[model samples]
Target chain A: MTQALVNGLTLGAVYALVALGYSMVYGILGMINFAHGEIYMLGAFHGILALAFAQHYLANFSPVVCLLGALVLAMLFCGGYGFTLERIAYRPLRHAPVLSPLISAIGMSFLLQNYVMVAQGSGIRGFPMEFGRRLTETRFSAFAGAEFSLLEVFILATSLLCMAGLHLYIYRSKMGKAMRATSQDRRMASLLGVDVDRVISATFIAGSALAAVAGVMVSMYVHAVKFNDGYIMGMKAFTAAVLGGIGNIPGAMLGGVLLGVVENIGIWFLGAGYKDAYSFIVLLLVLIVLPRGILGEQVSDKV
Target chain B: MNITWRGFSGFVFVAALAFAAACGPKGGAGAIRLGVAGPMTGDQAAFGEEVLYGASLAAEEWNERGGVLGKRIKIVKRDDQAKPDQATQAAYELVSEGVAGVIGHFNSGCTIPASEVYHQNNVPMLTPSATNPDITDRKYANIFRVCGRDDDQGRTAAEYAVKTLKVKKVAVLHDRTPYGAGLTDQFKRNIEKSLGAKAIVYYDGFDDKEKFFDPYLQEIKKKDPDLLYFGGIYHQAGPLTVKARELGLRAAVMFGDGVINEQYIESAKEAAEGAYVTFGPDPEKIPAAKGFLEKYRKTYQKPAGAYSIYAYEAANILLASIARAKGTDGKAVSEEIRRSPHESSIGTIRFDGKGDIQGSYYVMWQVRNGKFAALQ
Candidate 1:
């Protein structure tokens, strides 16, 4: 059970990273960024691309350096993509009904998935293990006589660091404050001289960067990257975000980890097929019991 | 408004013409169209692609050989998306397109629904990988399978585990899907029947997206099962094996044919190194399969999966029967298929009254260095 918890935590951390993007976007724009998952998938593809390029051109570089380069490249590319997506798909629908942008986001998701499918034929791309090897080497034979891999440790630590940084940014930074304000009241934030457009765009970029990191981590951990990775991972992250609190940043983190842990436990108690349903059931139960979320502050509109 | 109505009618007429043109003849009077259905997209796309590729190759071969009864064999491919509703739709489309027979609906979930359509349409459908006993038990006159059933596979794996591995205790993990749970049930029954009073722990199927299985592993560890049997596909099996190994569990991991894909190897990495599985008749061992394999590699530049060979054999049988029937008529072809001794890849295939393959053929395989190798 402890091992499952660790596994769930590791998985939850990745989901949390991706969910942060969704939560952040929702916090600022009050819109679910369905394209977040695609952005995450692009991050993984970019990581694979960077790794391939590095192996060919920068052979002298260490695996860690190459991996770091890949991660950065992935984040930058996906961050840019997120910014572009906001400009093209969401900008025009800002004043429109909530369903408009949501549908546009769904369309964008399909477009991205199909684009990748056509560009890269339907073959499962294997992420090279050169970098993964460095991270997941057996550390020590301690718990249940199992040895932890460096990759697993890196995943947990990297997730925590990213979460901590995000927390700091949301609470401590100027743009983060603008984002929080925008989420709270878009018109008020605009009146307070917060660039609502810029803040929303920045939210996408930040969330996308985290998603990109999560994507790379997933590719490394899973070792198989495919076009549809986004759909499944995206759903899970969205679930995590909702489970925590749609607009609560820290709530998303908690929700992600909780969902991951619950899924693993469900798999332990139930079977593999029920895992997806198990997580969804938890989400449903949480929504029924704590509709405002674990940390979300319930708000009401003035009558 | 009149102009627009005329234009719309014209468009509909043109589309109808185009559709007919697409289904137009390649060879003389009697072209046999064999329908192939599987998930060309979604998670199970790889399996579908392999099945389609194998069926296409068979069609090409039959057409090259002066056609079936001097009639060209054409394959009509449809994507089921591994969904029952889609499978039924695809089957309906294929039947309407006047296909002589169908080669699949790969998953049993899809096969069951699609098979009903084929039965209602009086179109003979041979499944390559839909192994649920209920599929054949329905005794649909039009439905048949070229592959071994789960009952055979589960029993064989259990026998190997008990007699060869000599594992005193066993724990079975399955996905809750029909394929997963059904196979697990079969394995449990066989293990218990073979080794009575020998503690056999049966666990329900888990989720594929789970991050950890430590709780289950912990329980299994406590039970001290000598071997672990996973009745699930590669997606979950891969991680389960890896995590189990990581947690210092030394039990040998085993699964059914679902774990036979190349993706499983990539997913499990070192954890799946020594995992065992039961597969259908070995393709490499079959003499007729060598030619097909060479052609498949030459055309696609990749070795086909084991199930693909079954697909090829199924397509071959369908075409052969069509040739013997000498027409695309469904009932006539079904009669021919019922009577015919199929000689193709995987040896001479003969179906019993229930459309199950006559001979009992199943093989045990082990994951050695990330590839399934025939276990001696």
Candidate 2:
């Protein structure tokens, strides 16, 4: 049971990191960023690729340095991808019928998935297991027999830090306030001298960078990355967003952690085959009982 | 325009007939045509490529050796897309092409339904990788498989787990595909029959599409099974094994033949060390296959994967059977295939009453030093 809790928390941390993207994009644009998962997938690919190149070029560099390089490359590449995605697929459809952008989001999701599938053959690839090896060298036991490796601790800590950083940025920073204003009323914010387009693009960049961190952490934890990893991960984070109130940031984090814990507890009783179903079941129950989610005060249905 | 049900049914019937006509194979008197069908595209395409490469190599060699029955053999390829319906269509297309015999439909789900089509047309169908026991249990005389059955390999795995590894508690998990679920069922049954139900600590399943197994691992860790048996393709087994080890579980991991590829070892990295798998006699080990392996490497620039040798032998068996029967007719070739023993790289291939290869056996393999070495 303790082990399940630890596993759930680790998993929930990654899900929350991903959920931030979905929740942030929805907070600002009132549209689901369906392509967020693909950005995460690319992040894993880029991180591993960067690690491989770094190891090859700088053989004597410490593992920490190589990993930091991987993290930076992944974040930069995913941020650029997120920015370009908005420019190409979402920007033009922003002013059309709301349905048009939603459809475009779904289409963009498939387009990115297939593009990656074609680029990387439908095989699982991995970063060197050296990351895991290094991670295992330092570990602490959380409780009776359930040990917490450095990787899990790092994932949780980094995720919390990112969430905290985003929280402070959104509440205290001028640009973040402008983003909040733009999200509130795009026309009014623009009239009040806010660059709405830039705010939306910045939102995508920040959200995608957080997702990239989650992706890199997951790849290292699991020891492999696949082209199709985006779909299920994306859906779970989306569920986390919806469960926490789609446009609420802290709610997204709370929902993600709760969903992961609930899923693990549910899997213990239901078995592993129904692992994916547990999230949906929780989503349904939440939708039926708490329509506005745990932290959500009311259903605005609009940004 | 309002359409009546009767009119719709007639339209459907006509359309079906026309579609059948379009897919029917054309008769070729110049070349003795042979067909290969498998998932040329999709997730399982690598397996299909194995069948294609090995079978094509066999045909190339036979043609170089003055062709079968004085006629140069031509190989026709079809993509089953790993689907039963597509396999059935490929079967019908192969029959229509007047191919003497076929060597395909890699997955058990595809092989089972598609073999019926080959049976109806009296064309011999020899699968290279499909291993479900019911595949040959259907008693189709035209159906044969070069690979060993799930039951055979599963029994081997169970015996290894009990008698060799000497593990007290065992947990079996499958991916819920026809191959995975079927193999797991057989493995569980054999384990229970040998060691009793209490010896088997836990049994469960997971969808093949699942990305993470930490939840399952955490729960299984509580049970403290010493041996974890995975019944699935390498894609899932590789990561599952890695994740299990990551959680500090010291359980010995074992799997079926689906993970024979070196890619499994690569993906699992150090975690793959000490893992066990059951497969047909290592083709690379047999002295008879040394030349074939060398030729294959020379041509393809890669080591022959698991099913490549099986496919080569399937092709050899089919062509030899056709030659022995002295015809390009499907019924005659199929009869010869069923009736006589033929020599090939694997060995003297002879079928049992159920059309499974006679004396088919599986050997254990272990990942040691990043390579799958045969475990004696």
True-contact fraction per candidate equals 0.40, 0.60
Give the count of colliding residue pairs in each prediction: 12, 2
lDDT string, candidate 2, A20-50, tens digits: 8999888888888888988888888888888
For model 2, what TM-score does chain A reach?
0.96
- Residue-level lDDT of model 1, residues B1-376, one tens digit each, is 9999999999999999887777666442247678899988876678899999999988888767777777777778999987778988998999888888999989887898888888888999999998888889988777899988899988999999988999888988876667878898898999989887465864655644443465677678767788999887766677677667755678899998877888778767777798999987667877878988889999999998767888888888888777778777778888888787887767888888888998777778998876889875
Comparing chain B with the reference, what is the TM-score for each candidate?
0.90, 0.89
Q: Which regions of candidate 2 fall more than 4 Å away from where they truly are?
A: A97-107, A292-301, B1-35, B39-45, B62-102, B113-123, B320-332
Docking class of 2: acceptable
Model 2 lDDT tens row, B43-101:
56677888899999999999899898888888999999777789899988988887878
Scored by lDDT, the top model is 2
Candidate 1 has an fnat equal to 0.40
Q: Cα lDDT of model 2 overall?
A: 0.85
